[model samples]
Target: MKAVIELNEIKRDFLVGDEVVHALRGVSFTINEGEFVTIMGASGSGKSTLLNILGCLDTPSEGVYLLDGNPVKKMSNNERAVLRNRKIGFIFQNYNLLPKTTALENVELPLMYNPDVSASERKKRAMVALESVGLKDRMMHTSNQMSGGQMQRVAIARALVNDSAVILADEATGNLDSRTSYEILALLQDLHRKGRTIIFVTHNPDFYDYCDRNIILRDGKVVEDNRNKVIKDARETLKTLPEED
Candidate 1:
């Protein structure tokens, strides 16, 4: 299997006033292509710091970070921006969709940055992405017209439209109800089964049983990183949940 992400002794430091705050210290790991991995930690454990680096939003102060074979630490801001756009699909806690924009238009936003994609091709790919998320019927609906789950699906569609190398989800289900969270997890599970490389950063313990592997962080360090021998099927778990009133 190809290594999609490789981090070696990664360290991130922040300056607040005259003090240096070490957010991540000597963190290292490798996430392979097609692997479904969950990164868990408490509020100050540096998972968010690590996510920012992995997404190319920030650079580490020390150590190496290889993303899909490209050295992220060596890239310029512009290069990193392009690399981020082309290689990583992000799903945030907030849906992050344009308020007045239709689902199809929102999904097409990423492709708009690419010179190679024509307007017609962008629409076509966005449609395919929405269809993959079971949102073809809601493609023309605006963000305000949809439920939380639907809006999240639209976000997922937008993430998928680029055929990105890594789907980096940050507390994706944090804002949803239990049933809705399970639905989203089921969708993520489906995506994983299809061989999509996913790196989910979350604190939800419920997520652990469903993922292929778990990586736990404590005090800016990786405390645990282990593959799951037995994984719970999200779809099956969803069936066991009580119906929402």
Candidate 2:
């Protein structure tokens, strides 16, 4: 498999009033295409710092980061923004859909930044994305009109709209109930089956069972990186879960 993301001795430092905080300390790893990798850590384990760097939202103070083989540190801010828009899809803990916008419009938001896509083309692509998430019937529903699970599905659709190289989910199931979380995981698992590269960051231990590999971090360094011998099916797990009243 091709390496979609590569981090070489990445270090990030922050100045907290006269004290220097080393958020990520000499971290290195390579995430290949079509792999579902979970990044697990406790609080202050440098997971967030690493997430920021991976998302292109922040640059490392001392290391090399390559996204789709493009050197992140060498890119200008605008270039980085463009790269982020084209290469990475972000799903947050809270579904970050616009409160007043329809699901279709929200899914189409990312495409608005790309000058090559016409309005008609944008709508077409957004519809296809929503359909892929099984939300075509709810395309016109606003965020307030939908349940949390539905909204998260819209968020997932928005992330998929760009056909991103990597889908970076940060505690994606944090806001959901067990059933809903399992539903989202099932959707993610389906995506992974179809060869999408995914990087999931979470503190929740339950997530490790679904991913191809788990990378554990502690005190700004990698503690473990291991592959799962057998990945669990989220859909099958759902069947075993007691039905919600």
Candidate 3:
């Protein structure tokens, strides 16, 4: 399998007052295409810093980062933004949908940033994305009118709108209840089966069971990197959950 993300001895530093803080210290990893990876760590563990660099939201102080074979470290700010917009999709724990926007409209927002997509094409793609997430019926509903799970589904649709090279999810299931979280995980698993690369960041150990690989971080360094021998099927797990009232 080809690698979609490659990090070579990446380092990130922060200037806190008169002292220097090393957020990432010589970390390196490669994530292959279609792999579902989970980055796990405690507070102050630099997992967040790693995610920021992987998502192209921040530059590393040292080392190389290649996204889809493109050297991210060599790009300027505008170039990085363009690369990020074209290749990466983000899903937040809070389901950052615009409040007054309908589900379809919210999903269409990402396409609006692309100069290559026209209005009609954006709508067409957004509809397909929403339908894939089983949100076709809720297309016209606003955020306030939907449940938390529904909002997250809309967010997922938005992420899929660009057909990105990788989906970077930051605590994507953190805000949802257990059953709802499983549902979201099941959706992600489905996407993974369909060959979409996914990188998930979480503190919860339970979620690691569903991922193909786990990278543990501590105090700005990678403490462990392991490939999961037995990946749990989220869809099957969902079947065992008790029905909600």
lDDT values, one for every candidate: 0.94, 0.95, 0.94
Please write out the lDDT profile of model 3 over residues 1-245, one tens digit for every residue: 99999999999999999999999999999999999999999999998899999999999999999999999887789998888788999999999999988999999987888999999999999999999999989999999999999999999999889999999999999999999999999999999999999999999999989999999999999999999999999989988999998
Error of 1 at 233 (Å): 0.7
lDDT-wise, the better of 1 and 2 is 2
Relative to the true structure, candidate 3 reaches a TM of 0.98
Ten-residue segment with the worst summed lDDT in candidate 2?
A: 71-80
TM-scores of the candidates are: 0.99, 0.99, 0.98
- Give the Cα error of residue 234 in candidate 1, in Å: 0.8
Candidate 2: tens digits of C-alpha lDDT, residues 46-152: 99999999999999999999999999998789999999889999999999999899999999999999998899999999999999999979999989999999999
The per-residue C-alpha lDDT of model 3 at residue 1 equals 94
Off by over 4 Å in 3: none
Ranking 2 against 3 by TM-score, winner? 2
Better of 2 and 3 by lDDT: 2
Identify the candidate with maximal lDDT.
Answer: 2
Cand. 2 Cα-lDDT: 0.95
Ranking by lDDT: 2, 3, 1
Candidate 2 stretches with Cα past 4 Å from truth are none
